[model samples]
Target: MIYDQPKFLPGGDRYMLVEFGNEMNLELNFMGQSLAQAVADNDVKGVIETAPCFASTLIHYEPEDISFKDLQSEMASLIGTLGPSEDIELDSRLFYFPTVYCDPWTKEAVDDYRAKIAEKEPDPEFVARLNGLSDVDQFVRVHSGTEYWVASLGFWPGLPFMMALDPRCMLTAPKYNPPRTWTPQGTVGMGGASTCIYPVATPGGYQMFGRTPVPIWDTQKRFPQFENSICLFQPGDRVKFVPCELDVYELVEAQVADGSYQYNVVEYQKFSVRNYKAWVESLDTSARF
Candidate 1:
């Protein structure tokens, strides 16, 4: 689809950043992703790789094969033919993740850092209050109530930066000021305007709320679901967090241990930005909080 003129900025010597817009928006993300796909399909020489983010595409190219000026001209020409972002269609997948919200693990982690890391209350409760919800139960309900769009994956492999598909489900929270020294793998957290699952235990800034039993990244790739790659989630995929009791979480963990657990995945063709925008606009503001 046709997009506004992109700002092409040089990213050091080997990379170029094509920015569709300064802000984070699905339309802008679509443009970036579509352009990245177009580049791959065309197999343009010297283009080593392309990384699409919320509103920009980072291109890594061989400087010896094509000059910066030449590559820039080629990208500009290719972008000119790309229709509009809204009209672009994406092949997407829907996944179901059984989550235990306010589980003991993340709750303990939040408590451990309450004096130094948290702003007011525990992470989950603080987030609940921030969203104007009455309690943690409502927070869990609202969080799992809508499908989340996988905007991109970063911070760690298979760690998806997700945006709620339904505008009414949108909730915002700031990242930790000092950041946490450690976050458990499978931890579900939210920072800024996106949500993500920690693929591996590591330092993070997102406020932890819940935990999922399933593994999103497996180095061995031994399971049937992990046959394609180590990372389970991808951009354009939709994920629905299903709240589950501790007992259910343990069952899933047992299945995972035996390598018999199959991820719930539904395949579909193309997401329409036009239709999504219409739905977003139709939702009442009160439904958001």
Candidate 2:
């Protein structure tokens, strides 16, 4: 797909922001990610690092080695050769996180919030109604049925903001009005138009729905999955939430406590945006839910 010219704005003396579009969509996100990869491939002088967001990329560079204008020109040149977002292929990994939906932990958290913060119905029921689903079970099915794309990692270390790969599975809900004071680590929540998995305990606004025993961030990097970094996710990776019973959740928690837990991951598949778009176009809206 053809996109409009990107807007390059001065973030500061050492940083620059390249915005592909103002809207949040896969096409813009893919372009941003593709540009980041292109910059890495070229290895342009003085360019320090690049952070790709939902629809923009932030580039850090040293002013001593290269002037801001020169670096901007270089980046524009690199972006020019990026061609089309749909043609970009990503080396993506697929991961499965065993989750217990509407579990005791999240239920308590939600109940606590409702008592202290807002007087409202249970979080699961609220989210389910907001998404046009009949009940919590149907909501869980819709959430876990489609693959979610890890658009970017932010808010806190290893926390991933995920977007549903299938449009039919996409659901939207408003964030908590005042935000939660503390969200349990491994809590799965949705805010605005995206879903996220909290890597650590932190304050948040996303509607909490489930809790996963699997660790998304390991500060010690004890497992093989976290060998490269403490963060277990990266842009372009895909995650599927597999609903589990309380017994299975406790079993995984025991394994995790003993450092014997192995993450279920598949690295065989490479994501192709062109093919993905085509597949999405072919699917009927009813099939998504």
Candidate 3:
């Protein structure tokens, strides 16, 4: 739930955690991102950087430059300037990713996890059944029908924690019981209304469904998009997964291997919270793509 006022809490000596709400929703995220931008635009003194999460922003500051009390005061003032969530407009990039749904890689991983750790249903079928979808085909259609918002990056370097932007596509699943020993790189998975793409093979809990050949993180900076940061996504970026066949996935993989693949991106778009709210209001929540 959203708090009546923002809570400013201390994070050690050099960090400040400003929480907008306890629940995970886009409205709270807008407030967090707005405050982060306000800090940068207002040139808040002693602030090193701000990391905005789903419902809060973690502020890194220099104690020698600004005292905790004074920093709180400055941040409070900035929060006041942010106005309301509906009035917020932010620069957001849209990325198109080619994803292979119900892929063999994630299936094999799930099978191995069940054999080694615990016995459970297949990831895709389990999620589909839990969500009341007819089958995996419908599940894939619903999941890929809408764009996902990158709410934050966590757990792994460059790993994105995202939420479905369209209300119709919203789906939830339980994570693995003991957690998988490893997940394939670029695997797309979902848990608790959030979707994520694995940046690298690592221990994971989300129910996996798809795999993308395009790299979301490249330490070598092979692509032009990685010029500024090794991570491909920021908090406000959006992702649209395009379902593809194994042959297409392999083709893109080959292109990526030679550093010849180009990322499909729309960089000039600005996300308007007001417009989004209006669209959501007009939609039938019971409907699915």
Index of the highest-lDDT prediction: 3
Q: Give candidate 2's whole-model lDDT.
A: 0.88
Evaluated against the true structure, the overall lDDT of model 3 is 0.92
- Give a tens-digit lDDT track for model 1, residues 61-125: 99999888999998998887788767756778898999999999988777777756554468888
Q: lDDT for every model?
A: 0.86, 0.88, 0.92
Model 2 vs truth, CA RMSD: 2.5
What TM-score would each prediction reach against the true structure? 0.89, 0.89, 0.89
| Model 3, residue pairs in steric clash | none
| Number of clashes recorded per candidate | 4, 0, 0
Q: How many backbone clashes does candidate 3 have?
A: 0
Q: What ordering of candidates by lDDT runs from best to worst?
A: 3, 2, 1
Stretches of model 3 off by over 4 angstroms after superposition: 9-15, 42-48, 61-73
Q: Which 10 consecutive residues of model 2 have the lowest summed lDDT?
A: 1-10
RMSD of each: 2.6, 2.5, 2.3
lDDT of 2 at 218: 91
